[model samples]
Target chain A: MFNLFLKTMYDKRIFIIAWSIGLAFFAYLMLLFFPAFKDSGLDQLLATLPPELKALKGMIGDISALSTPSGYLAGQFFDIRMPMFISVFSVILAVGLSVKDEEEGYIRTLLALPLSRIKLLFGKLIAIVVICVATTIATVSGLYLGALSVNVNLDWTVVSNLSLVMLLLSICMTTLVYCIGLSTGKRGITMGLGILVGAGSFLLTTFAKSVDWLQPYEKVSLFHYFPAVDIVKNGISIWDVVVLVGITILSILLTIILFRRRDVR
Target chain B: MTIQPVLEVDAVTKYYGSFLAIQDIHFMISKGEVVGLVGLNGAGKTTIINLIMGFLRTSAGKIRLFGEPVLPENAHKMHPKVGFATGDMSLFTNLTGRQYFAFLKRAYKLKDDKKLGELCKQFNPDMDKKIKTLSRGNKQKIALISAFMSGPELVILDEPSSGLDPFMQQKFLELINHEGAKGTTIFMSSHYLKEVADVCSRVLFIRDGKLVKDVSRAELESSHGKAVHITTSRAIRPPAQSSLLGHQKTANGYEMSFIFKDSPIKLQQWLCSISYMLDFTIEDHDLESAFSDLYSKDKSEAKNV
Candidate 1:
């Protein structure tokens, strides 16, 4: 399993490095712009703006959320952009890990070894999960570094909990991509569904916040359960954690079952 | 006690949706048997091979390797005993040949690098070069080396010599012979008749997704005839009592070719009865002629039907 994991990650070094560094840089850059806004009294100026415009800026809940370093990081990054970034990264890795091998005829050679198919897939799955964790950590650490550089010490408790939420969201989205890719063995389908679901969830979340009638539809979006603002403003919800974790486990189980049943093309 | 065969494909059938690729195929290879699968393009040879390798799910029937039923989920258990190479397989283009071998070694959990090093030297592949840069023949050599380096009990090769030069082809034959001598069962497919006849103990001929012929090497050597090619001074029709296989016009008036599956003296007597031949040459019937004869006969039979 470890060998398979190493081999799967072998060709993905560039992708992992680029996404991790990009996420970290985005965090650093976003945090770098925060103090200037705080010093210029733009937070109060922003508070006076119309609610719809605020929702457009991805600030739907508390106006105070953007005033602090933790709230600013979660509200600006984790709520919208971070989930999008992580979902894209996760989908690429997961889909590539599950389907690309069979497409490239690598699975035949691997299956010819003494390892079982389930074990081989699990190896690739574990590698993808590890990559997701690394990118998440990089983004969170960048947030921490940017916060400390400005002498605005972040609450580790809230930061860790928020990171966990992001990671769970990533797991749920990636496993969905994996299941689709494994079942269909078509990169196009996996990618199309991945983007539609990954980015679409965010779209639904924002639309739900902006429109009163669409608010009920937010429950269907995976992003709804993460509640980045809720984590930042109040505390992490155990029920939300349960929902995200449950979705991930269910997706994985379904992926494995469907993969075993489908023919390897 | 009767020893179990190395491979037993019993009543195996495969269908791709509504199109039947191979149907009711049955064959067995005992230990140390070198069997050659031969056919024209799209003759279901590759389909059968993929079925045995568990790359495709059998629409019906079963394949047993070393007495163990082979299925997609349990296919890996047979991997340690089976080494397979195919022209259709795609290698990782990004990795150097050496890196790819190292990766396989790790997957197989084998510690010996000496076999890989020896194969690299024997095949003379640029080990450090990326696979995408190598020529097709060199990539083929890489695949062959990977298949044989492990000294597996059963080696499956599909058109293994397709991209090889004459020298490498000879080496590959020698390798197959060496493996057979070591009691390793080898199943291969090829277009080269003489090579298959030289190394394989038995040959399986498939046509239109059916096993049409299965003959042993001894049977082929004794019963296969010689081809007689005769050129006439004029475009004269065959004699009213002639049993020639085929007659076609050449630069010369006409040339007639046919297999004489009888004593050379009888063939000479039959030739003596023909008075108009200007030139004639009798060549020993090889696997190629015998195979072509099978197809020609099949076509005539199909037309008659």
Candidate 2:
């Protein structure tokens, strides 16, 4: 089963590597080249966007003290880039491992095996988590390496801190999408819904702030606890850690329950 | 000969909404026997297999596998004990034949890679190309390998010879016979009676969701081939048919080949009186005739009924 997960994860390595490279380039161009834009809130760029788009990319984390290489790298990677990477990773892993198997007729072969449904789902979830962690660590390290060429002070504390925070948020989103993927028997539906859930949460959170009446809806949005911007500015909060763990438990439990109850197509 | 029944289906009836697919289907297969479920398309052969596999719910009746009821939760686990290859089952397109074979081998918990390789080499299915690239016959060979890879006690194949060339079909027959010789019970369903006759020890005839015949190989061999044709050496004496049976004249003479349900000897004596000397003999019955006879009966009886 571990081998099965590894085999599937190996197939998606290209996607992860490509994404990490793209994230590194974005981080380098925005942080190193255009330094002033870090604080410059282009109101047109931020405000003209629809409410959903704004809500999706919650308040940007303050990277003010991010003068050093590691701080700037961590601020960019973990603040905005890591969440996107994690969400994409989570959604793809969840959908690929769950729905794609059925859509491609591999599930027939997989189910023909002498394993239980829960076991297959459990192994896939573990594989998704492992991929998420490996990709996150690589993307963060790559961002830092990109900063290395620019000659800035290194700070492992900030990088590790940011990684940990992003890891928590990423796992939560992955588990949630993983469950949704299991519920959706087809690949297209799973992929579509997974993207919506991940990106939609972010937009919902941003919209919640602007519309006072919709603020309560923000509490349920995963971006509410993601704290990408907040974590960089204020460090990790105790409540965020607690809420993240709670999210993991809730999502995993839902995944297991859905797997057990849902019919395997 | 005393032998254990390898598979038993008892009073099983399944319904898809108001559409009744199968009704009270009951049958059993002895150990090492090659059993064929003979049915036309839409006669509910697949439905029966689905119920046996616990893929669909049975509204009534029960199916016992090796004397144990197949519980819903444990049905998937039964794969190791039973190898099933369906004609319409979708093959994984991305995996190469080798990869797919290896996957099934591991899934079935066959530790000996050498054995798996040897078994595959016997059929010589292509390993380099993905399933999507393979021809229909080659793809079927791959499917057969996966189905037989587990070396289970029972193998249920639906339309097993479908899409195979004559050579492959013969190979398929040999493969199934090999499994049977090794004490594997094969319960295959096919619309082609000749194919089933090649390997099946018993033929179970199904029509309109009912089992009409459970004839053994010996019985089928003896009866399925007997065809009766009566010809006369002399002209008929009276009204087309006195009352014995419908009569028709041929180039030879007046002839009547009413359904011959009696021994050739008895019918010979009876026909001798009708003509000075009659040229009459029983022609072997082929599947086409048996099928036509049965179907014609069904149609006629249905109209009368």
Using lDDT, give the best candidate's number.
1
Candidate 2: stretches off by over 4 Å: A10-13, A20-30, A33-88, A184-192, A254-265, B1-5, B13-23, B41-43, B54-61, B88-93, B205-213, B222-285, B289-305
In order of listing, the candidates' clash counts read: 0, 11
Residues B1-305, candidate 1: write the lDDT tens digits: 99999999999989988999998999999999999998888889988888888777899888999999888777788988888898755777778988888877876777797877777778888788999999989999989988977778999999999888999999889989988998999999976777888999999988888888788989667546677788987665443322366677877768886666677787788778777788989888766767777766443432100
Task: Give the DockQ (2 decimals) of all models.
Answer: 0.67, 0.30
Residues A1-265 of candidate 1: C-alpha lDDT, one tens digit per residue: 9987887677778888988888888887878877875566656876888876766554443344567877777777678777777667767777777678678887767776777878877887787788789888988878877877777878888889898888888877887788788777888988888888877787888777667788878888888888887897788898898988888788778877766655676
Model 1: pairs clashing at backbone N, Cα or C within 3 Å: none
Q: What TM value does chain A in model 2 reach?
A: 0.78
Model 1 CA lDDT for position A102: 73
Q: iRMSD (Å) of candidate 2? A: 2.9
Q: Once model 2 is optimally superposed onto the true structure by TM-score, how far is the C-alpha of residue A134 displaced, in angstroms?
A: 2.5
Q: Candidate 2 residues A141-169, lDDT tens each? A: 66566556555444566666677877778
